[model samples]
Target chain A: MLCSDSDLPAPPQEALDALCLRGARLLSGPVWAAAEVALAAPVVEAVALQGGRIEVFLRTPAAPDEALCGVLEDSADLEAALNVLWSGIDAILPEDTARTADATRRGP
Target chain B: MGDLDRLNSKLAKLKGKDDGQIRASATDSIVSALLTEIEETILPREMILTNESGNRFVLVVAGRRLLALSGHGAEEEGSEGREDAAARIIAVFRGPFRTFLDNAREISIDAARPPNRIDPTMIGCSVETLTAALVGPGQASVADPVAAACDLAVAGLRLVGGDVVGRSGDAAHLARLEQFAGVGGAGLGQLAGDDTDAPCCVFLSDAGREDAILARIAFRGAAALILAPPEARAELIALCREPIPAAG
Candidate 1:
């Protein structure tokens, strides 16, 4: 769903989930599926992890440096594997930024 | 000269030294040349990513591995049992290009693992098909072969010049392009031949002088290719994220 133009920092994961669920109720399997997958890796985190659910809280918006939020359960046994995956994610981020920025300036 | 034009020249010069159809086996030189130019010249300094949109997706990638991360829609699962999920992800993005790769005109494979080894099977369909598949269906496709060529030209032109730029058959060919708005002084040049017909070129502004001129020829459409500078790559990627219409 399109966000309002209030310049709000992306709300915490919990809040985002609420919004996503509220707008497109869970009965809609496709929308629910997309949200579930999208939440796994984030450029930023609005929600802190609690027992089983993640707590959503708005973070201070980054001005110059943007943060990505990835949602992996704190319960995973593969901390080492998760760390490596994060490293790969971090590695390509700069590339992604540059490419996206370049595309924007060139304007197709 | 505009940033785009300069890279074009470098790519052309890079390819000049390579003799094709039968060169001693080594890393695919053209792939290496393109990747190197992108890493060294186009990514050193830039904000590369922006938050223009609330969401974030990869803006660029450098590794030879075509990376993928897949799992279930809601339930977390191990890689062992997610083949279906992986297939679904690829199905959404991959298009006609799969056919092209299955039946490529050329297939170069390297059994030995070297740093720059490329699986010939990875080559997508024609450049056009690959671009469209990656960008998305219904999204307008722009063929900036000139920019792609420019990247090669910048590397090639920088490494080798003179005789290579002059010859028509295998050497190189330079061609001029019509003027456009912000792209005023810019033009395109190409280097091509029968055996290794990799098209390469440069985009140059009127104010910019060629580092080396090609000997005049019939100019049967040989545009230049060179490496794109960092800033230009960032700019180009950003433009790619425009919101797609619901229909598209």
Candidate 2:
């Protein structure tokens, strides 16, 4: 399934578009897929190609963790990859949200 | 009576209490007594109190004389509340008796000390005592360099990319380390000669040589690179996106 920009939360539109464009270009071969997960601090972009290779990038922070990139040879591997990325993103979002909330309350 | 005697008498009510309770009571007593003295002597002036931890408490005294200190009559709107300032002062106090005495002495001697006099050695001084002497009871606090750097790195770094490579132990098992060694613009040869074991290095350079420079550092075991030029960010991200070669 193709991922839409609306799938992500409140990230900068420009960054989300750029991330999706890059993902599409990189995964243009056989089965291309892209997902953007909106997060308070940084939006997460996950791109997967037919060979099961996936690249994840964090939008605002711009950090990339390529350790998870590998060929997804089967459905089980795809499920495991999705679980790992979603779990990692879920874990980081709460802390980021709390920090953003705290900063807002403290004022500039 | 001497200032110490006055402070001691004021704090006498805190005697016969446990150490923690004594300290707590002493700080409250000292802050109240000091603020009262400041109101009487200094009149209506704006002042800030800072503790060793770099916390600041501001007091805006309202009155004609206080306004005259700042060459104005209208009360300064939005001055920091007195209760918050007092609480901050109490939080950093070490020993109630010593801190109160020292704070009192500083207030009493503020006009006598030379404006150009360097601060006395703070080698065994608590943060509250040091700050009390330096800032006095009704003075503004100065910025602390270390704290400022920490705030900048923590808060300001949001615009810059947060951790590009996962920190120390995120799968790469890279050690958490930071070091400033070698001058900028050094060739790969100099970097190789210096400590390659440092997990991160920031290079000062124009964007043109980034690709070659980045590849060289990656080969030299630098897990992360922070380029100085803003234009280098995209190139750096692209470099990071490249797949790691298979281990032979």
Q: Report the lDDT tens digits of candidate 2 across residue range A1-108.
A: 124435446546684565455443322321111101000111223222212122342222212322122222211233345445544643444465646645665788
lDDT by residue (tens digit), candidate 1, B111-212: 112234334443212222323444444334223332333333323221122223421112222221111111211111111221222222111111111132
lDDT of 1 by residue, A16-97 (tens): 6654443222212332232223222121222222222222211111221433233323222222333344344434346766
Task: Tell me the TM-score of model 2.
Answer: 0.16
Candidate number of the best lDDT: 2
Error of model 2, residue B27, in angstroms: 31
**Residue B49 CA error for candidate 1 (Å)?**
24
Which runs of model 1 end up more than 4 angstroms from their true locations? A1-108, B1-87, B91-132, B138-199, B206-248
- Worst 10-residue stretch by lDDT in candidate 2 chain B? B65-74
